[model samples]
Target chain A: MNRYLRQLKEGILDQNPTLVQLLGMCPTLATTTSLENAFGMGMAATAVLICSNVFISLLRKFIPRQVRIAAYIVIVSGFVTAVELLMRAYLYPLYQALGLFIPLIVVNCIILARAEAFASKNKVLPSAMDGLSMGLGFTFALCILGTVRELLGSGSLLGYRVLPESYPDMVVFLLPPGAFLTLGFVIAAVQKLRGMSEERRRRRSAAPADTAAGATAPVAADGAHSAGEADGAGRKED
Target chain B: MNPNQPQPASMPELLTVSPSPHARRGVTTSRLMIDVLIALAPAAVWGVAAFGPRAALVLLLSVASALLAEFLAEKLLRRPVTLRDGSAAVTGLLLGMNLSADVPLYIPVVGAVFAIAVVKQLFGGIGRNVMNPALAARVFLMLAWTGGMTRFSAPFAYLSSGVDAVASATPLASLKGGMLPDASLADLFLGRCAGCIGEVSVLLLLAGGVYLLVRRVISWQIPVSFLGTVALLTFVFPQGGADRLSFMAASLCSGGLVLGAVFMATDYVTSPVTGAGRLIYGCGCGLLVVFIRYFGGYPEGVSFAILIMNALVWYLDMLTRPRVYGKTRGRRGDRKGGGQA
Candidate 1:
């Protein structure tokens, strides 16, 4: 149980597919123009990822090493086809909205990467957990981007009017160039946040050592270390 | 005498030392721009003659506003002002040519601001802009002030008689709105119609285009392929064909095709760089122009088509990349020598 939880944490937070690994950008940019579309795409990709990961893990022994890639793709496409048909029957509106993107799941690098790197070697249960976590992380990132774009682009979110009537819609936010600009800024923000946390970790690690060393040196060493840590934190924050 | 004077520094020593290819010919940016300006004079004169002095007024206003906006934006951004590059002037002239003389003077002012300040400078200016500044400004103004842009009443001062200047639709607009009047091929070619100031005279625009070609300021691939595609498509599927000649002439002369295929679509900043890429870009622009004209809401689609092709220029360049000097063409996997073993 502890091992599975660790695996899940690694997939979602420590190594998020979208934010950390930066995989599967085509669907991320294309279908994330709206929150509803993002949700539909995220759920569809998650379902396919989870099913393919589990099945590929289970059949790892039977698949030939030479043809494993081809085999994995065949397995992924089967699951994707099943999800595509289910969406068509049950969620017709979302099905129409997503259109060709649903089939494009077959080409999504994240799914194939997970299958080749993790699922092919891991146990079925752990593989399934990894799939679930990574899919959820991707979904979260998509939702954040979609919410921003839809709100700014059309002054609405999930069909609800959030912005005031006086606000002029920035129509360009929904255009193709907007996708590149927003994604670039988002990546830069994530990098900045990571840098901040790394600095905090360094300071926290140094604080106890400084206090321990202060007993020997009295007061000067303590002041020096504290100032050093503060300066490091300041640089990171800037 | 110089050789005797100093034992005399040999000819090589007397000459200023520089890197290999020490010989150079003069082709400065300013000189290139001056050439373009000279080449554009015939068309400008033709436009003034066709539309009266208002054409000249619009052109001057657009140029002045573009320069002012570029200067102000650069001053605010603390970047060196680049008006001397002559790109802003070119953008201003193109913007003026795209607009009708009767358009409110403030419209061109707004367009100049959008063209220079927003589209060009904000995107890192001149060569760095991804799309054509003039076309982007035209599209921006068209969307922001659609009514003001679409109303093409004759210039008030240009009225020869005491005739009430009618708000006549351009030929493209007329075709799209299903209200095309009986117009001859001669009128379309000779600038006897209501259209954007410079777009009326196909003959004069062609003269400028030919001069541009002769000067090698632009390559022929883009214009030839673009115009050829539109002509072929229209010949095959013209809606109103009284005869082949009328159909071909109408398709060729009507709308902003002359302006677009000759000047706008051929814009250096927005177009592809390679020979094959330009051909593909031109064909794509042509197809989109015809598609939008026949099926879409807009009467004319030259601006939209050029903008769309501008967005695709990167992809087209990628597709048509010239092969490396000594590399052999091979399939993706095969390039790794997978089948050789």
Candidate 2:
């Protein structure tokens, strides 16, 4: 249970598939042109990821080391095929909306990377948790980007009117050039925020060392009585 | 002291030195661009005379708006003001020439803003843009304001003279819509038509083209290959033999082809620098123009064709790289050397 919890936490935050790992970019950019399409594609990809991860973990021992990559691909393609059929049958509209992208998920680096890096070595429960968490993380990131693009491009959110009628939509935001510019800026912003937090941590660690040195220097320069008094207060605080 | 001798009492002097080609040709960017502008004058004058003073007004508005947009974008982006590069002015003039005389004033302004700010400077300015800035902006504006762009009527006075000047579509538009009346080759050559400014008069536009060619400001290959390819394709697969001459004339004379072949398609940034690459690029553009005009929804394909070809220039250049001196054409298993096997 503890191992599964650790695995889930690592996948969700520490090594997010979309943000940190930077995998599965084609679908991320294409499906993200509309909010509805983004949500549909994200859920579809997540379903494939979880199923493939669990199956790969359970069958890890039987797969030979030399042809492990090919074996993993076959398993992934099986799950993806199932997902594709289900979507076509039950969710035909979304299936059409996603178009050629559902088949492309079979090649998404995230699923293969997880199978090789984690699931093949880990037990089934932990592997399933890893898959679920990472899939959710990817879905979350895609939603954020989609919301921004759809809102700015068409002045709507999830097909809902968010901005007033007076606001002019920049039609370029929906074009190919806009996709590149938006993705580049969003990645840069995330990197900048990470850098800022790291700086904050360094400053917090250095502040107490300076204060402690100042207290020690004055105590040492004074007589034994002052030194004893300073030591006593410091020990009490500690 | 001998007059021929140098002054001996002077301390060692610092002399500024420059690289060996110190013999300089007196050509500034401003002056070169100004000369190109002068070269473009005959076409502009012909357009105005044929279309009237409204063409002149569009030219003025487009030039001013392009310069102003360049100035404002530079200020906003904190880049050094480069309005003096003469590139912006050229862009303005070409854009003006492409537009009909009576297009709404705001349309040119919007087109100019897109040209200078988005297409030019955003891609790193002057020589760095991937597509011709003027054409890119024009296409963007055309897509955005399709009603204004395609609603080109003849000059008001030309219409008022009982000249049977209906809201006639351009020859390309007529050809695409399958409504071409029996237009004559002679009429097409003479500038008695309704079309974009600077595009109605093939002879006058050719005069400007000849001047540019004589000046060696642009090479002959791109223009020749581009126009030649279109001519060949039209002759080979024309719609009808009865109107063959008119079809050929219309193909050359209609919207933005002369302007694009002579100027816009030859843009320094978007066009390939090597000779062979440029020829290939031109031919590709010509083929696309014909393909789109014949089958696609758009009436004019010059802007889109040029833009698409611009995207392929890098690949074309790679494929047509100049062979290095002393390199063998083909040698097997020469992996140790720089040559490919």
Candidate 3:
């Protein structure tokens, strides 16, 4: 259970395929013009990710090592076709919204990356878990980009008007350049947050050792208390 | 000047140690930026007089926001604040000039912020930015709100009916339709027309350009080659079946061609450093302007043309590199004995 939770955390935050690893940029930039389209694309890609992962793990032994990449593509395309048809039958609106991207999911590096890196070596249950977590990570990133684009681009959220009627819509946010701009800023913010957290962790780990060093330094300095104060200041600067 | 002759202890306080090439000059970034601001003053004043108080408001807001954004960005980035240099002021003023005076109050503010923060500072500020910050912001705003950016009120309409006046068509729009604008050649030359705030007055912009040229603040290669190319193309082609001379004059005088050629394209940081490269860059801009104006969706193409050429500046510089003395024509990579030098 603990191992599964750690894997989930790693997928969503530490090694996010879209934000951190930066895979599948084509659909992330293209279909994220609105929340509904982004969500639909995310869910569809996630579904394909899971199916392909499990099936690839099952066929791992049978597939020759030399031809594994070709075999992975064939498996991924098959699962993508299944997801596309299933969405067409039940989620027609979403199906129409994410037109070319549905078929293009077979080329998404995240699914293939997991299959090659994890699923091929892992058991079925673990492979399924990896797929579920990575897919959710992709979905989370898409939804974030989508909400920002839709809210600013259309002055609404999830097809509902949140801003007042008089609010001037920044139409650029709906365009291609806006997608690149939004993604760049989002990545910058994520990196900054990660850096801050890592800094805090480092400081916490170093605190006791630092105090012990300071205590020893003052004792070695004998009665010169100002020397310890100066040493502390130097350390602070460092 | 001998190092052994040093006497006073205060000398160390005055002199600083540095690398070779010990020559010194009084020229500074702030001085050059201030010179640009001085050169642009006449056109800005003419724009305000021709348009009205609202035009003044746009210029004021743009300059203020640019300064504020620059200050905030530098502070946030933990760099030494360089607001006194006046580059941001120039960017703000140029951005204001590029915009129609009739744009909403927030438009200039937004554009100024984007120009300073994103285009200017984020790319390592001042000399390091790849594109002209004002031109990039203008394009961004134009793409964002096509309707708002295109709407132009007739000159002095604000004096009569105020800011809510109907959008008067610009000469570029008329030329785009393959017909001459209603304004006489004299009116267009003298700045009695509907257009962007600073761009309506060709005479004033030229005056500013001439001032920059006289001060040796800018080289003549860019503006000369740029304007010469546009003049040659439009004269030979003669859009709208209008008389060649008049059409050529109108095309040169109308739109942001003069404004862009004089001020924006000649921007020091974005244009090529080599003289030959500047000429090619200018001609490229001129060709693109005519091409896009003739064929593109937008009626005016000055900003887009200049921007597209701006992106190619590094390549142009490399292509036009001067030969090193006693070396072959090709680059170091192509020569076997190049590394020894």
Candidate 4:
């Protein structure tokens, strides 16, 4: 149970495939122009991820070590094709909107990376959870970017007129440059919050021993992270 | 960082002392900024005088918003506030100058905020940004609000606000359609033209440029090469006219060419440091202006040209890198053996 919870934490924030590990940037940048498109891309990529993770985990023993990468791609592409056809048959407009991207999910780094790193060595349940968590993280990132771009670019939200009529539209946000700009800022904010939390965690863990040495002001920042971890362990004894 | 050092015996003895050059110089970042502000005063005065209080209001709003944004950003980023350096003020003033006087009051405020917060501060604050903040903000305003950004009013519109304040075509617009504007050479030179607030007066802008030169605030390479190239190109190919000289003069005097070349292109942080690189960057700006003016949809290309050249500044520096004296490690076996042979 603890292992499953740890995997969830890792996938969501600590080792997020989109924000931290920086995988699957193609779909993240291309389909995130609107909330609807981003949601569709996210669900499609999640479907592929979950199916690939389960199948790869089940066939782990049969797959030869030497041919693992090729085997993984074949398995991922099979699932991607399934999702693509299902979308084309049922959700035609979304399929047309995300036409090339659905098939291209086969090459998404997150799915292949998880398969190689976690699913091949783990059981089916935990592997599925990993896929779910990573998919959720990617979806959250895409939605944040999409909401910002849509609101600023067209003064609307999810195809609804939220802003007043006089609100001047910033047309640049609809262009390619706006995508990069919005993504860059949102990612920067995420990283900043992460850094602050890590700093707070370090300070809290180092509290008991801090009285003996009046202040352990970091003389150099190079080894500060590791030193903070060491201090956390030291406080465990007290 | 050295906390174990001996404490000062008295409260007044805590100051650290260093050796040599004890006399403090009068120059500082703030002083240089004040000099630039002083140099820009004449052209700004003329712009306000010619375009009326709307131009003045734009300038004031731009400077105020820029200062406010700078203060907030520095505080948020946990960096020391340096708004007293007046870089933000300069950026806002230049941005206002680039705008058409007829734009809504909120345009300058938005441009100023973007200039200070995004272009200047987000890229690591003053002296660290890759492009001129004011020019980048102007380009953003131009791209996002095309109608408001390009609506030029006739000269002395402030005097007769009802009639002349209506939208009028700029000289650069007529030049785009292959003819000169109705304004004559003397009117263009003396600021009786339809254009951006501060860019109409070629005479006063040149005077400001000369003031900066006299004060040693800027070197001459960028302005000289930039203007010289535009002059050469237009003189060689007179569009729709047998008189090449008049066309060349009109090209030089019209639109934002003089304003951009003198003030925006020579921004210290955005332009290259070396002499050779500065010349090449200037020539590149001039060529791009000519190219865009001739072929692009817009009549004026000063902002775009400067921005496009701004991106190449790092490469320009690398290509024009001055060889250091003691860097003799790379002339290896092939060159020495081939020379001997």
The alpha-carbon lDDT assigned to residue B284 of candidate 2 equals 96
Interface Cα RMSD per model, in Å? Answer: 16.2, 24.2, 13.8, 12.9
Q: After superposition on all CA atoms, what RMSD does each candidate show versus the true structure?
A: 11.2, 12.2, 7.2, 6.3
Give the per-residue lDDT of model 1 (tens digit) for B154-253: 4233566765457776777756654343457788787777788778788888888898888888899999999998988877876653455556568789
In model 4, the fraction of reference contacts reproduced equals 0.32
Tens-digit lDDT string for candidate 4 (B208-327) = 899888887889999999999999999997888638998899899999999999999999899998999999999999999999999898888999999899999999987776654544
* Candidate that scores best on TM-score: 3
At residue B44, what lDDT does model 3 achieve? 86
Residue by residue across B1-341, what tens digits does model 2's lDDT show? 23433568987779867789877888677776886788778888877886777788888889999999889877865578988878899999989888987677777888888898777776656776777888988887676556677666664445367553346666776667654533455566666667778777777777777887787778898999999998888767776453665576668766678888988888778899899998999999999999998888888899999999999999998778776566644343234346552
Give per-residue CA lDDT, model 3, range A64-157, as digits (tens).
Answer: 9999999999999999999999999999998998998999999999999999999999988889889989998999999999999999889999
TM for every model, in the order presented, reads 0.61, 0.74, 0.90, 0.86
Q: Name the lDDT value of residue B114 in candidate 4.
A: 89
Per-residue CA lDDT of model 2 for A35-123, tens digit only, reads 88888888888898899889999999999999999998899999889999999999998899899999999999999999999889988
Identify the runs in model 3 with alpha carbons over 4 angstroms from their true place. Answer: A210-238, B1-17, B161-164, B332-341
Each candidate's number of clashing pairs is 0, 0, 0, 0
Better of 1 and 4 by lDDT: 4
